[model samples]
Every structure is written in structure tokens, then in C-alpha cells.
Target: MSIARARLAVIIVSYCNADDVDRCLRSLARSDLDQFEVLICENGGEAAYTNLLARLVGPDRILKRISNDSDVLDLPQKRLASVASCRFQARANVVRIGLAIDNLGYGGGVNAWLEPLLSVPDWDAVLVLNPDTEVDPRALSELVAKSAAGYGMVGGNLVFDASPDKIINYGLHWSRMTGRVIAIGRNAPVGSTPSAENLAKIDAISGACVLATRACVEDVGLMAEDYFLYMEDLDWGLRRGKHRIGIADKAVVRHIGGTTIGSAVTIEKRSDLSIYLSARNSILYARRFAGWRWICHFGIGLLYAARYLIRGSSSAGKVALAGLLDGVNGKTGRPKVVPGAR
Candidate 1:
């Protein structure tokens, strides 16, 4: 399919981040792409959704002034008025918002929003994006262009929101020997001179912003629900056998990493939830794909715990150890409390 004719749907799963959702919607309103639809799955319940609506559609007019045409989308009748449509010349594009009754985690929230759209044949591709991201004007267009060229999955260059000049992730590199997943182009400075090597095939793309064709989703399936948050993208990528994964260098996104889950900059400040999930899911992913190499993955978890203990981060150490044990014991889903919390 050609870029102009291809139908695109963007899904953003947000949890308790009204400001971030507002910013993301505003950025989408300014996109260079002629037409597309956006769905914001607010997983923080009715309160967060109310705050988000105020920010996006309030008298302040944070989003661009756009006409809401009734026939733009055949959304559920109850929330049809909530869908924002922009009249760009003769074409009407849509922006729909919905609320989850509870916190559904990242993957569950996305699936909840996406399951309804799967029956609609209008969209040719879906872009799953984080609320804590701002896409460049050309980002969606470039991603769609790659999808048209037959790449099943595609990602944009991701830069830190605070340090836009520095690259945070181009994609991911997974190692079978050590059962490790590493972000490519991490902390690399964006050079004044552009390099052809910027575009390449990658093992996996960051879940923060990725585009997938309808055909790919049908074949490989949706994001795994086993991982409440972390490693779900990696698992999806691994399952997409032999399908090409492309990194579009021109498509840039500024991401506020760990906005919902705590910062990685400081050990103490890191959220117990983030540390626990990362440790638990890494082991689960390895067991699913690495065969006998799963032992190495378990050992890596031990190393993380040991390092945390050595650094006097007892809480983080305890969280990691607890996560490792849970994964070994085949435990999954959200924990009742913060792992290792008394």
C-alpha cells in the first residue's frame, strides 16, 4: 500500500499522567501526516480521564482548534462525542479518548483499547506509543513510509526529552548467551553530520514508539499480557519470526523515560515496581526463548541483587531477589504490594 492511501491508527496507553497525555495529543495535532486516527486509553480511571479532557479540550485550547465532524469514525455511541475530529481541507481525521475503570498495566491497557479496533477493517496499521513522548512532525509519516515499503515493524530514533541532543534508543539488541537486552545508540550524541548508518535492521524496537502492520499483528499476535509492563515489546519482537524490523532515522521522538515508572538516573529514586518487573520479566522472557540458557538469565538476576546490596541499596536488592524468586516460582501479574515492601 502507498503512504497516502494507507490507513493508520495510533494507540497511547496512559496511567495517571494527564500533563503527558495533553502534550502528546498537542504534538499529534501538529503532525505533517495528512490523515490518521488517535486513541488515548486512560488507564488511571475516571478522575485522570476528567483531568485529561480538561487539559486537551478545555477553554485554554491546548490542542489546535479542529472541527468535530460526526461521520469521521463509527466509535461507540456513548463516547462518540468525546472523539475529536479535525477538518484538514476536505478530509476529517479523528482523535478518540477512552477511560479504563482500573489501572490495567501497560500491555493490558493497550489490549483493552486495541481489541475493539481489531474488528474494524479501515485501519491498515497501528502505532503503539507511550504518553510520555513527543513525536516530530515527520515521525508518523516516516514510519508509515517504511510500513509501505514492507517492513512489518518500524521504530523511530528516540532521544531523551531532557537532553534532546543525545540519543537514548534506536532499537534494541538481545543477546542469547547472557539473556540480556540492551538499547542501541544509548547516550550517543546526535552529531551535526548525519550518517547513513543511522538506518539499520534491529532485533527489537522500544515499546515507547513503534509501528506495526495489520498483517504482522495477525501473524505474531498482540503484546504479551504475561509481562505487566517491561519486556513485553521484546517478547513481541522475538515472536515476529523473520519479519523485518526497521529503524527510521529521520523519524525522531523525544521520550521522558520512566515517567510513569520512576527514574533510572538514581538507584534510590527508582520505583520498586520498575525494579521488580524488570527483574521478573527478564527471567520469564529468557525461559520462554533461551532453552538451557535460562540458567544464565537467572544468574544475571543474582548479579543484579548482589550489585544492589554492595551499593547499600537494600530495598532495591530485596526487590530484585523477590522478583527472581517469583519468576522461578511461575508467578505473574501485578503484585499486591511493592515487591519487598514491609
Candidate 2:
């Protein structure tokens, strides 16, 4: 595929954050690349759906809701009634909005929007970005350039939005022994540059900003929904078949980090949902890819629970234990219990 001139689809999954989505879209409007369409999956229900549409379309203009057998997709007849609509309408395309029937998590939300477009021949690549990120003007262009160079999957440099001088990660490094995933170049100075040779050796690309060729996506299939929240990116990188994954160093994205699930660098700031799903998904990852080492991964999960308990966070400890039990018992999909204050 001649990706340089090939049109791509940008998929953003938003949950109860219209303001962030608005800001993200405005940033995309300043991007150098214009051959792309935006697909948004609103997983936060009716109120969120309405608020987002209001922000994008203004109070007077209403977008019509189009429902199919599977889910609700809202597509406006014309371009969005906003100043930032030019980028979306560059190819005479209206932004496609998907209202998820339920909270489909990250991977499921992405798959929801992608399933319909699987047969569409217009786009050659799909860029999955979190709605909380703001891309630099050249970021999209850089990603397309890398994709054109033959990399099947690509990611950008993610930095903390609050402190742009600090780094989040170029990609990720997953360890099979402890079932732990570490962010490469995490907390390093923003000026630090990693060699392309090093960037190609990562275990997985960060999910915050991943661009996969349509061929790669079709080959590897949809991301596993069993994880529901975390680890799906790693799973994708692991199951990428013959495709190669790399990082586009010039593509920079400012990330507000984890707001939807209340995840933070510290355990004290993490929400119950973040803690639980991460623990449960690690075991699931192990069971699928760790072979006989799956037992060791379970042990690691137990240790994580004990560590939480020992650290004097009983609520988090209990949540981790619940996740470990669910993981070992072969539970999958969304969590059965609602994750809130215990």
C-alpha cells in the first residue's frame, strides 16, 4: 500500500469527557496531515453522548442518530458545525460517532468502531488514539511517513501533559518472568533520543497512540476483548503475526494520562477498576503466552496483592485479591462487580 498518499481512519474512544475530546480535536485540526477521518466511540452513555455532540455540533445543530443491529452510530449529514471541522471535511467526510451500548473498555470500544469499517476500502491504516491526548502538528504526518516506510505498526513519543519536559514512554518492555510491563524511557528527559534500532526491539507499542496498517489489523484480527481494559496492546504486539512494530520518534503526543479509570503512577491514586483489571489481565496474558510459566505469573499476582496489603492499603489489596481470584477462575470480559468505593 502507498501509505504516504493513503487515507487513514482516526479512532478515539471517549468516556464522559467532552472537554478533552474537544481539545483533542482542535489539536488535530492543526495537524499537517489532512487525509483522515475521525471515528469516535462514546462509551459513557446518553448524557455523555449528548454533551459531546453539543460540544462538536453546537447547541442548535443536532446530529442524527443512526442505529444498526449491533450498535448506535451518529453521523452528521454535513461537516461538524465547528471551526475545527475543516480537517475532518478535508476529504468531504463527516465525523462518525459511535454510541457504545455498554462500557466496552478500550479494546472493545476500538473494535466496535472498526468492525463496520473492516470491509470499507477507503482507508489503508487505522490510528487509535486516546481522547485525552493532544498531538503535535507533525505527529500524524510522521506516523504516516513511518507507515509508508514499511512498518506495519507504529507509535509516537508520549509525554506527560502537565510536565511536557518529562517522558511517559517511547514504547514498552514486558518481562515474562514477573509478568511486569515497564515503560521504556519513562521519566527520562524529553530531550533524550533513543536510537531507531532500540525502538524496534520493544515488546509492545503504547496503546495511548498506536497506528496499525489495515493489512496488519486484518492479519492479527481484533484486539482481545477478554482483557477489557489493560494489556490488549501487549497482546496485539505479541500476536502481530509477521508484521513489524516500530516507534516514530518525531511524533510527539501530550497525554493527560489516565483520567477515565483514574490511573496514576502511584498506587494511592489508582482507582479500584485500574488496580483490579491490571492484575486480572496480567494472569490472562500469562495463560495465553507464558506457557508453563503461567503458574509463576499467578504467584506474581499473589505477591502483588500481598504487597498492596503490606503497604497499608487494604482496599487496594482486597481489589487485587479479587482480581487474582477472578483471573485464576477463568473469568473474562468486563468485571462482574461494579468498581467503585469499597
Candidate 1 per-residue lDDT over residues 1-342, each given as its tens digit: 012222888889888888888788777777889668777777777777778777666445554335443342434323222343332223345566767656777887777656766765667889999999999989899899988898999987788898998888878767888877877778777532223454343568889998988899888887888788888898888788857887677888899978888857677778888888888888888888889898888998899888988999987899988888888887777777766952
What digit string (tens of lDDT, one per residue) describes model 2 on residues 1-342?
Answer: 012223888889889998888888778867888687678888788778778877776433322322222212233212211112212322333456667777888898888777766855667899999999999999999998998889888987789999988889888877888888888888777756767766755877888999999999999998788798999999988888788877677888999978888888688998888888988888888888988888988898899889988998988988988887778787888887843336
Q: How much is 317 displaced in model 1, in angstroms?
A: 0.2
Model 2 has an lDDT value of 0.78
Which one is best on TM-score?
Answer: 1
Worst 10 residues of 2 by lDDT: 77-86
Q: Give the Å error, residue 238, model 2.
A: 0.8
At residue 157, what lDDT does model 1 achieve?
A: 76
User: Which residue pairs collide, candidate 2?
Assistant: none
Query: Measured by C-alpha RMSD in angstroms, how accurate is candidate 1?
Result: 4.2
Candidate 2 ranges beyond 4 A from true positions = 1-6, 59-93, 338-341
The C-alpha TM-scores of every prediction are 0.88, 0.87
lDDT of 1: 0.76
